[model samples]
Target: MADTLQREHAGVIPGSRAAVSAAVDHLLERQDARGWWSGELETNVTMTSEHVLLLAFLGLPHDDIRDGAIRHLLGCQREDGSWGLYHDAPADLSTTIEAYVALRVLGLDGARPELSQARRAILEQGGVAHARVFTKIWLALFGAYPWEGVPSMPPELVWLPPRVPLNLYDFACWARGTIAPLLIVISRRPCRPLPFSLAELVLPGTEWRLRRVEASGPFAWADHLQKQYERLRIHPGRSAARRRLVKWIRARQEADGSWGGIQPPWVYSLIALHLEGMPLDHEVMRRGLTGLDRFAVEDDGGWRLQACMSPVWDTALAILALRRAGMPAHATPLRRAVEWLVDEQIVGGGDWQVRCAPGTEGGGWAFEFDNDIYPDVDDTAVVVLALLEAEQTDEVRNAVARAQRWVAAMRSSDGAWAAFDRDNVRQVVYSLPFADFGAMLDPPSEDVTAHAIEMFSALGVRPDAPLLAPAIAYLRGAQAPEGSWFGRWGVNHVYGTWCVVSALAPLHIDDRAVSCALAWTERVQNHDGGWGETCASYRDPSFAGVGSSTASQTAWAMLTLQAGGVGDGVAASSGARHLIDRQSAGTWEEPEHTGTGFPGDFYINYHLYRHVFPLMALARYASTDA
Candidate 1:
């Protein structure tokens, strides 16, 4: 392969083979002693701000921690004196309010230049009165915002069975974990008095009123009734609900002290337990509070918290990239990674079992190191594929078989797979007043379904396999008119199209659709021989596959073209050139966020993307240079 590539295009890119070698060495060097890989999961300043507030709410001292986070927050503020959900995004009212409040809590003077500028940005964006429901709830904690102005998620939701319309399981697992605890906080209405006031956040004439209702009339009316119910202190089933909720929250806390292995649930659950008289010195609270240190990264740049960690996801992807780059399966890093991943498999039950097929024994991987109850189909499928590269052991084989069954059983009714739930396409949940953040339901997405299909194909599952055919149909039905697919977990159309095409290309399924997608990839290629898409594409279809060139999206585009059997085509070759030209020592520098947490609400810059993906694209392109 190296000889053929050299004879054909060495002049066009003399460093192609060298680039692949450098990237491989770089990835090998990145392996941790434990055989896992983790890149910094960077979101906006809201995570850091929330961390500070969480410690404060618990009456925990954050002296130096507070100063470091304040530095990080101030550094992240835009020239407009506001924070955004993603880099270079328009100022988001909720994010600005949260950061401003965090700065205040960290003891920055409201009259300081930074705070004054932020206050102006807040008022310009409709002031604190227009913040999201979640933001308002945070303010209400410190007696800044009125409780009546925030939406009510009554604790009574705990009693609803799975079969009921608004049952606890109806919400996505993350939402379920968060809402269960938040219900306790709302009912308790616990307030921790702040040293100062937020009177400056309210515009001169603006009063606390329900911002323009984002939910349906009926849902809004239901929330109003709940508020009135709270006013009357009417509670027939409140005690039973609270007990169930507390028990439920206590049962799900991971060993690392986080709830659901994410920030929202972790912070909120601690507060809820504290409100219910769980002592700070108790083992659970102590572990939960201190476990947050694992998520914090402090340095010259100051401190920031990850919204969630991604070691399992990062390790699987890194191993797969090495294998794709033609690394031997017996290579030391690959062997260690496979063994570690095999051990990381969750054999215990989780919330997913509620909606999964009957008798679906747990054998899947969670995205985090310790989240046993939330193993996702996406991570499990990818891990299975990576494990196949290594010589299978009895333990590896057993883990694989169990994972296959779990993935198969996780199929939603639409013949597709969601990240954490089966058939979790509850639309009514989005109509609730509290559902302001982007995605409340974990509906089946094309990207995850594609991964599942690819895994089955590698296992030689027949085309007519029960899950295979319907999953293919699901992808077919999901393709946009312009031929791209919607990326649920990644950035946008480019990521989704690459995943689907990469899966279908080997099966020779829907040749016309594949060709159409290939054309779309080519059409969206930037003038500079790469591809990019803004996170805005999630809310605005017109922005699909449109943005400044970045290594990750370019690699996704290159892979899509190669999957369509056009690795030598102009678009693919140029994308390869783009990666080769931009390489330095083995990795590209990517500051842009290419990962999605929630479509319009949260975004992530997986620091490893600049390394793993470009290498995968360049190596595969070189060996398969038709």
Candidate 2:
């Protein structure tokens, strides 16, 4: 493998056994003594800002969190005076509107220079009147934006059956949990007056009747239809619909008193409980607040909140990286980590069971703690894949079997695997005026499908297995014209190509598409000998595999080339050198948010990826022949 390849492209390579060993040691140090690694899950300012708004909604007094949140928001504001979903991106209207309102709630006067600048930016960006549905609802709660400004989401949506299109189950678990509570909030639009109003933030002469200008696509009129439907709530069974919706909402709350571990659901659930007449001291309310507070992280720079937790998910990935780096499966830390994962399996029913075939045993994992009610296919597959790399005790094998069964059962009719539920491909839901965020449905994505396929392949599932055919077709059909696949969960084409090509390696497949993908990877190598794809790639495919080289993405490129059995040794060696040279004190400097939380809407900085991925890439290099 290396002889002819190394001769084709000569260059210095930095990867070594020592570098791999040091990387493995650093990862081990981060793991808890009991076994599990959890790095800080970082998000944008909106999380902390929403934290303040949630506190205000509950009538909580001023506290240091409020002060620290404001500081964090201020620190994140660009010179143009608006907050982007991620740092260094352009200003986003919804985020800026929410942050401005949060600052006002925290006592920033209208006369403050920063406030004035933010207000100017808001007006420049069309002001609060033009913000998204959720932002308008937040402002409406304060009697700042009118209730009529936001789209009406009737609680009656709760009545829709699972078999129907646009039903509650059609949405992903996060969106489902977040939107159901808003049904009550929308039913009886509660107002919590602030000492100040956003009068100065509103654009002059802007009408309170917000138009759905941004809503466009097939069923664009779904916006008008939704509003008309809201008016129909005045008919005979309206009260029944409302009550049933509340019952459904209350029933779905997780054991931790959260609807889901994510911030949107946690905050909205609290507001929904309040609207249901639950006092702040009520057990549900108290537990919900405790769960919310647990997500907060305060540093000397300031306070911020994670949108969700990912310890289990992080630990699983870390184990795989360690194993690839030559860490024995029976290593003490690896054994402990696998034990923790086995214990975390969802052994009972969840929202997934509503559509799952009867007798399909319950077993999967979620992205966060205690989110047992909604174990996602992505986490479950990754956990299974990691366990396959570990010593397969009976417990591990049983865990894998249940999870594999669940994934196969959850497979969409298109033969693709989605992150959340099965058969959840509802396109009409995307045309709603309230669904302006473009994440209305959890459709099958390449990265997710690739993970599952790789899991089957790694487990020695036969090439002729029933699962391989549709998946191969899906991957072939999903390949980009530029010869890459869109990475739904990671950065961009590089990550997707890596997953797809690697998974296909374990099975005999048409080599043409795989070759094209490898060629693209070869052409995109950075001048510094690594690979990178900007976060912007989520928006513009032109930027795919284009940006400052990073450790994780470089690893993806290296592994993909190595797995595809293409690319000269020079490309592989140079990529390895980049990762090795970048390593310092057993860690890589990666402040970039490499993880994707919500494709284009949100991004995450998973602090563990930099170390884990580089080690995996280098380890592959060490084991391969030249």
Candidate 3:
């Protein structure tokens, strides 16, 4: 394989082995004493700002936290005086609105220069009237936006069955968790007093109405009708529905006191429960608020909040990267990581079981420390692959068996996989007026399916196995004419192409598809001998595989080239050299948001991506026979 590919390109870059060793040391040094690895999961300023807002809504004394968050928000402001969804992106109206309001709530006067600039930017973007629905809801909580203008999500939505259209289950798990609590918030329409009015933030003559994104003719009308229904004071099933929603929300709270193990749902759940008369001192609210302390990260710069944590996901990937870098299963770090992962495996029922095949034994892993209710297939598949490289003791073997069975049973009707749910492909949820936030459906995505395929292949499943055949066809059909598969979870084409190519590499099938994808990866290689893609690619494909080179994305392309059996090829060598040249004291520094939450709407800078991925790429290069 190397001989043919070597002739097609060039040889591997020098110093790869030393670079791998340094990266290995860097990663191992960061491993927790508890036998796991995690990095700060950074989103945008919205997270920190929302933390302040949540604290304020609960009337909790948060002087210290508020001071830190204010500093963090100030630091995050761009030259034009706006906060964005990701680093170096254009100013987002909603993000700026939230940050500006958070600063106000934190005691920063509107006359402060930073707040003034942010105010100017908000006005330039059409002010509060143009912000997203969620942002408006946050404003409504403080009487800054009108509750009548916000989209309606009746708690009665819980009454709908799974078989019904536009039911609660139709929304993606993240969205579902958020919407469930939001139902109570909307119905209650609780408004706390703001010390200062946001009159300066709202555009004059603009009414508090839905923007284009929030208005979908019929859905908008339905929202209006729902408001009318509320005004009429109809009391049919309101109490019953609120009880069910409260029960639903409470049942899903993780051990860490977060609902769905995410910030949006967690914060909203606290507010919803509080509005429903749950006191802050109550166990549920106390745990919920106390758990948030874990998500808050304070550094020399300031304090910021992670949108979510990723221990299992990071540990699994760290294990894979170490194993690829020649760390034996017997090595202390590897052994400890494997043990932590085994202990972390969720063996109980979760929301995934709702749509999962009946009798699918429970054994999956979530990204967070306690998100047992939502163990995603992506993490589960990665965990299974990592465990395969371990010592495989009886415990490991049994855990892997159950996980593999759960994964197999979770396969979608089309024989592919989604991140969270199985066969969760309902599109009607997207048509709802309130669904403009982000993706509402957890449909099968190419990157996730690729991971599933790769996991099964690692377990000795043949390329032609009946179980994998349909999945292979799914990937083939999912390929774009230009040869890149869409990355549903990562940044863009580079991530998806890497996933598909690497997954199919061991199978030695799809030669033509692989060739086309290989050409695409090489064609997109940056002049710096690396690869990158902007979050904008999620909005427009022309930006795919095009941006300033980053450690993580460059690693994705390098791994793709190597996986296509061209580890010695010119493109692979260039990418390897790029990684080596960019290496610092031990690891690489990446500020780009390489991970996707809701694509264009939200992005993540998985702080560990800058470390683990580059090491994995460099190690594979050092070990390649080329």
Model 3 ranges off by over 4 Å: 1-12, 208-214
Candidate whose lDDT is highest: 3
Clashing pairs in 3: 10-570
Q: lDDT by residue for model 1 over 1-626, one digit each (tens)?
A: 55544543433455777888999999889899889999889999888888888878888888968778888999889888989988789999999999999999888989999988999999998888889888988998998888878778889888889999888899999888889999999999988979999878887767835334445688878877787798785688898899899999999999999999999999999999999989999999999988998999988879999988999999999998999889888888888898899989998899998986677799899999789989999999999988888878898899999999889989889888889999898788877888887678998999999999999999999767877998899899999999999998888999999999989988985899999999999999998889999999998999999999999999999889878888766777778878888988788998888999989898999998878888878888778543
Weakest ten-residue segment in model 1 by summed lDDT? 4-13
Candidate 2 residues lying further than 4 Å off, grouped into runs, are 1-15, 208-235, 566-568, 624-626
lDDT per residue, candidate 3, 1-626, as tens digits?
55634543544456888899999999999999989998999999999888888888888877887667877899889999998998889999999999998888888878989989999999899998888889989998988787887888888889888889878888889999999999999999999978889889887767634323366578878887888898875669898889899999999999999988899999999998898889889999989988988988998769999999999999999999999999889898889999999999888898788886677778889999989898888999999999999997999999999888888888899989999898898887877878778888899999999999999999888878888899999999999989888999999899999999989877878899999999999999998888989999988889988899999999999889888888777778778878899899899999999999998799999999999999998888888645
Model 1 spans with C-alpha error above 4 angstroms: 1-12, 208-216
Please write out the lDDT profile of model 2 over residues 484-592, one tens digit for every residue.
Answer: 9898888888889898888876575668888898889989999898898888888877899898888889999999988887533678877877777888989798767
Q: How accurate is candidate 1 locally (lDDT)?
A: 0.88
Q: Which of the two candidates, 2 or 3, achieves a greater TM-score against the reference?
A: 3
In order, the Cα lDDT scores of the candidates are: 0.88, 0.81, 0.88
C-alpha TM-scores of all predictions: 0.97, 0.94, 0.97
